[model samples]
Target: MASLQNAKNESHIPAELLIARVMQIHACICKLESLKPSKQVNSLFTHLVKLCTPPSSIDIKTLPQEVQEMRESLIVLCGRAEGLLELEFATFFAKTPQPLNNLNLFPYYGNYVKLANLEYRILDENGVVQPKKVAFVGSGPMPLTSIVMAKNHLKSTHFDNFDIDEAANDVARQIVSSDIEFEKRMKFVTCDIMQVKEKLGEYDCIFLAALVGMSKEDKVKIIKHIRKYMKDGGVLLVRSAKGARAFLYPVVEKHDLLDFELLSVFHPTNEVINSVVLVRKPLF
Candidate 1:
């Protein structure tokens, strides 16, 4: 995968071939009413992931107008596929007696485990070793990152999870309800991130989920809003993407985080799909 900061020179892959592959994957994804565990569905997703793992020769910005439109449409479709997958498993786990134990049932649960560990390491390196209170914006129906962090890493940290969908929040609450410790530590708020201005300052660290803002403009708006209300010196971790992964998630540029002091950005070369951008609110 290409790191946004240090992308390699363009590869020799033909743009037409790439577009064809993208279209094939797009068609398969579109046919799905909901994501489930099937050999065919698994194979399709595997191919999709492999297709996106390589650095593209064609710069997304320099793509032909029609190709760019296709790219945008594909990205939106992929995001919806991901959401449906999460909701499918979240609804399933919500009815189970022990949701945490059944997390493995979700095909991508291990990915979230890796992501949580990665983010935790970034926080530790940036002096946020033990954030007392953390806020996760756009925490979807699964809320796997918070659940993983609370269970494995930040045992004592209190998490305030915000989601625009009340149904998602309800499913998230039920998913964690059986765990006594999680029940005490995790609180889900059903509202958009933009509406939680006054309470933002209370968190030691804030996480912006990858799908929080599908467009660059909307992402910048949310980031700026967080910068305005976040406490001085607070840590902000925004999930971004690079290289071919940018086709699946929005890429956050350094300039998008205008007011915050840019700390570090890590783009994983492995199966970890989202890039992590860590920044801090300037004390001054």
Candidate 2:
């Protein structure tokens, strides 16, 4: 649909506070990275970096080389963080579903449920049902989006999770396998979307994760690639950022999705992210 206003404007958080947060996040990243060469550490570092980004008004480029380099490094780190975070989350929950306090998972799950509800409402309005194939690009380790959708929506029989990290895939599979009932509803694959050449048009629904792309350019490319393989009239649910969350990465604007018919846009009343639902345009 059309672009909507954000629930709140977070730019008023104060420049001094933003600077302080950057320092805190930077120190945390340094400490975590120093501990080991684990993927979890790398993922945390990337998150810390994204959380550290200041508002656009403050130009980080004017800083010293070292500082500028640090900002630059965060860009690269966030791209890797997706797979790394999946690996970390998968390892943590592989034994049990309980999340550690340090993971700060409650907000994450809450946000997922909020967005999933939006997906559910749209599907219901459109008369979408179960036994329909659904694929989640960038499923991460937990696949919480799919899990939430399954629990809340109860539609979409087979949910396929695709990610580049094999470890992440293993974690998702383990989590899904833990529940025999859910086992049949979910499948995890460890290939990048670009690598899957055939049978890509089978899905009735697709989800592109919030952190799937490294940059705006990358996101556009990924969307364009997936658009080619989508079954006509199939729905695409994209989780995008807004307001404060835009600091993590630039949010997808209306122009970014002109190739598809924008069905609707849903902004979370309590959360930071938004959802954009679209359908493929007819071949001319």
Candidate 3:
């Protein structure tokens, strides 16, 4: 309760205390069969989000060995919670008569809207104007980013969404199937990004979702694979994390991006869960 109070107060939460609190919350999140809107769960998530916000400086390497041991598990737990929330909504929307119209009912729908706007602005600034074809790697069940971007920002661009899970792709397709415009613009492919060899070069821009690779090694491998197949001068937008958010998501460092020309890295000091890393494939 004290740790919860500390999170509410927005004080400098001790790393060990924060870790313990997260473990408790994770336990609660795991017990749920479906992520229905519960006041207790919502309050827990609210406190966790507050704790993860700005003003907390936590370096993963500097933590004690025991605490470090819990980091990966915590990340996995958080990712599972996120996936459950998405699947819950995706399943609901898939069953609905018109899912697209009810998209705003999603709790984190506003986050995707803001994120798409930010990514669109970044792409526009970096000379990716009116890209004809774009690809989104690891697009989950909801695929809200692709929908939001295609519907709002890049009205003319076609979005090819790649996800490893066939069920997720099915859910995504069902969610967007009712809209005629989305049916024309959004295409869901059920395959890993590594499997798409030749078609990768067709895209002018690619977005890598945050939960694509949960480990640094896996992330580097995916990045290298994309670099090998992606067209020259293609734009890559990676969703990353900074500050306390690293506790919930994997962090991508500059060194990990070896071949790409680093363009911009924007870390929001607000509630946005992901930081954006914009880079480009060199023409040479």
Largest TM-score belongs to which candidate? 3
Please give the CA lDDT of all the candidate structures.
Answer: 0.84, 0.63, 0.84
> Tens-digit lDDT track for model 3 on 57-152?
777768777666566666776676677688888999999999998999999899999999999999999889989999999888999999999888
Q: What ranking emerges by TM-score with the best candidate at the front?
A: 3, 1, 2
Q: For residues 7-123, write the lDDT of model 1, one tens digit per residue.
A: 222234466765666676777777876666456666666666766766654457776787677767777766776776798889999999999899988888888999999999999
TM-score for each of the candidates: 0.90, 0.72, 0.91
- Which 10 consecutive positions of candidate 3 have the poorest summed lDDT? 2-11
Q: Residue by residue across 1-284, what tens digits does model 2's lDDT show?
A: 10112112334556445555555555556555343336656455434434433233544424556644554445444545544555666676767754322233532567567667777777667656663788889887778778878866764468888988787787778767777778888888889888774556888778888777756678888887887777777777776654434434445767888888877776554543454555544444
Off by over 4 Å in 1: 1-16, 27-43, 55-58
Better candidate number, 1 or 3, judged by TM-score:
3
